[model samples]
Target: MKTQRGDIPRRLDTPDPAIRFYLFHGADEASSRSHATRLLKAFGAAKDAMEGGAIKSDPAKLADEANALSMFGGAKAIWIEPAADEIVAGVEALLEAPGAEHPTIAIAGALRKTSKLLKATEASPHALAHISYAPEGREYENIIEQLCREHGLAPAPGVVSRIAGMTANNRELARQEVEKYALYLGSGESDPVPLEDDVVDRLGAGTGDVAFFGLGDRAMVGDIAAVQEGVDAMSANGSEAITILRAMQRRIVMLAPMQARVAAGEPASAVISSMGRALFWKDKPVVTEMLMRWSAPRLARLGERITDLERRMMFTQLPAKSAIGEELLAVARIAQSARRR
Candidate 1:
């Protein structure tokens, strides 16, 4: 039941009723999440929102919810934001239970190929699983176009690329911008209109500069001083701890598969080169060096630690900035040690 990212849109257009759950996981968690919601958006179906951790302790809770009767007498949809391996048993129960009245969607960050959650989801006949990497080139354009359509905008030619550029190719940004267009166009879920290029100009005129990702870049190269400096600057500039931590986690997700490829004996240069436009050309040199430095195991462990830190920031009353900053500095020290040995 593993689904390709390209086919996600078409499948959403005509979702299978027999499919009880959709698993969207990969490096591009934002995109994965947006896509997961598109299913509900498309059908105008409201979701019973839940966190991914809800079923970790009570494995049967997932199955119970799936079979629960909606008060409004409709098939309810369950949405689990930020899915993880802990929910594998719960998802297994949902899959095995007969006649799940609700469909479920679980969005996750990068998952290992052998992940129990991923494997269970893929193996289930009742679920569809997909991995989202950052989209590149034509795929980027396609994602924007699809978002516009889902949000009820009928963007004209050149409109998609302009929005893509204005949003700096961030799919989530592009999605939000398109929602603005839908509002401007007086468009609705069922009624669409011409989303001219001029509309992009009027609404997207003040789109801010792309976010700084140097904190992650420095951490990968084990530049402790730079990492600390970047964190200080960001904190002074009023950046949130969760935001900073999320950015670092993204770097971990982005490097993971490439590290694996290198661990499998592929040349780092070749793997980086093969990324084509998926990776920013300006960062290619640094990414290549880091890929050489961080092995697959290291990257995987780092990803887990970041995920745990991010979860704590969400669930606990922790000082976000300092905790996240400390994590990044620790990562830098580890990278520096790797350099020495």
Candidate 2:
């Protein structure tokens, strides 16, 4: 069965022992592994259960390990870490003749949503697939609350917003920061403590700045030089290509609908003014400029291309930075072309 990220907690609360195979795949590696660990624990398996196996995309060996008797001869939990597309065949074999003594959870890296491996796992009667993405909006809030409940911390009102501001688009980092905050509060204490705004600021210091800092706004406005500079700065600061690309993708999603409205005969100034009220104060200027620069059709095309770029970054071994750079430059070229016309 396909599972939503938010549903994972509820599902774990009442896990199905009969579901012996779990496919945890997504760009969010931290969230994926975290979920896998929870699934293993649900099956009464230790965190170190994968240490005993010869795993990693070897389907035949995976099948053998699944069917093979454990040293203790009880329910076994075998993990396949960083499972690639090659493991699909092995997973297929296991499903055909599932003698799985324990849950065989496969933790995969960023996979295309239409991946054959992912599809196979989802289609299997005995397997559950959970796709993890970066948490946002209400989902992000829910994660904060959930983490607080798990670690016995009470969140003061608006603490979630403060935590969200500090974390900024990274689910794993947010989770870790929450845990750290909880630890700081509970140190040498016998009971949970209420997490206040001051405590949050103190514990979450130095986490407010995101690596991809203004790149998204630059990309939206077709400021290619600024975007390139931002990318370089972010790379120097230890940001990943996927992280930068995701930031750009978010801008595209936000701009596409507004551009579409403009194309359908709304005035750009009116649209910008309306959207500005809804947009975060800091982002309104660039978004307004981009709305003026891009037409409806062009923004739609950009949206499609951005989606494709995201897929390539996730599934292919192609140079993500190069691909993203080329695409952003192309967007800048479009702006240049518009100016000439």
Candidate 3:
């Protein structure tokens, strides 16, 4: 029997017991589990009727279990962990068979373009969805904003970018950090407060210098003494010059878009909200004012300089101290320029 294929079905039809299967692949265990739970719940009352089980790397058992009938009243759901080629043949067999008996859900840790499992799942009547662990560009920012809104907090200005950079493309890690921050702030506040560097430092211990974001914020606020203190602390913590440069680079990139949006008369609240869900702290107003002071031309110049410094840091073997010092000086100069403006 030829099974239906294309986009995965989001919901199952009732009266007649229809088996619905979903496939999710990703490195982030949290994301995979979250997606699986959502699909399971979407099946309505049938969710309770569904028998749940997991399939290992073996394919024969996977096929047999998927083809088996449900014990109770409703459909059966089978989640295959780390779907690999060895299991693809069995999965394909199950897909090819008439799926009148049960529903199957496969959860994979990773997926390749040429995998038979992916192709079969994609082509099968079962629903197929993917969850990536990698934080792609603005998606991380979007997630942070959503989380903030859910927690009834506002993310301080530049917080999203700072958090995003610190996590270094790890969404699950970023999510954990955000959750910790929210917890620290407590859930009772009616208005959002600015998250302090100490909070972030406590959450992201031993990864790198926490003062990077604090310094960036101080620079944004045109606080020379605070910025200098942050730099000094960062240096003392054994942070490399290139790392500092990279942090500065990330800040400039985050600020450029924000400054542009703000200059066009966009509401600060709307601008920050659009960036992501993280609650903006009290310092948002200060950050907003800093954005207004920088102007587009100056921001552009800073970006260009940061990019050049980043290239040198990546390609050359210059002393870490000298390289970092130059970047710091550049940041200080830009802050001065913004203050003057």
The most accurate candidate by lDDT is 1
Candidate 2 matches the true fold with a TM-score of 0.63
C-alpha lDDT values of all predictions: 0.76, 0.68, 0.58
What is candidate 1's lDDT per residue for 105-172, written digit by digit as tens? 89887787889999998888889998877665567788788887888888765566556545544678
- Between prediction 1 and prediction 3, which has the larger TM-score? 1
Ten contiguous residues with the weakest lDDT in model 1: 205-214
- Candidate 1 displacement at residue 98 in angstroms: 2.1
In what order do the candidates fall by lDDT, top score first? 1, 2, 3
Stretches off by above 4 angstroms in model 2 are 1-7, 48-58, 67-76, 110-114, 156-158, 187-192, 205-230, 236-341
State model 2's lDDT. 0.68
- Model 3 scores a C-alpha lDDT of 0.58
Instruction: Give TM per candidate.
Output: 0.57, 0.63, 0.48
lDDT of 3 by residue, 227-286 (tens): 566556655423444445545555566667887887788866577667553434544666
> How many pairs of residues collide in model 3?
20
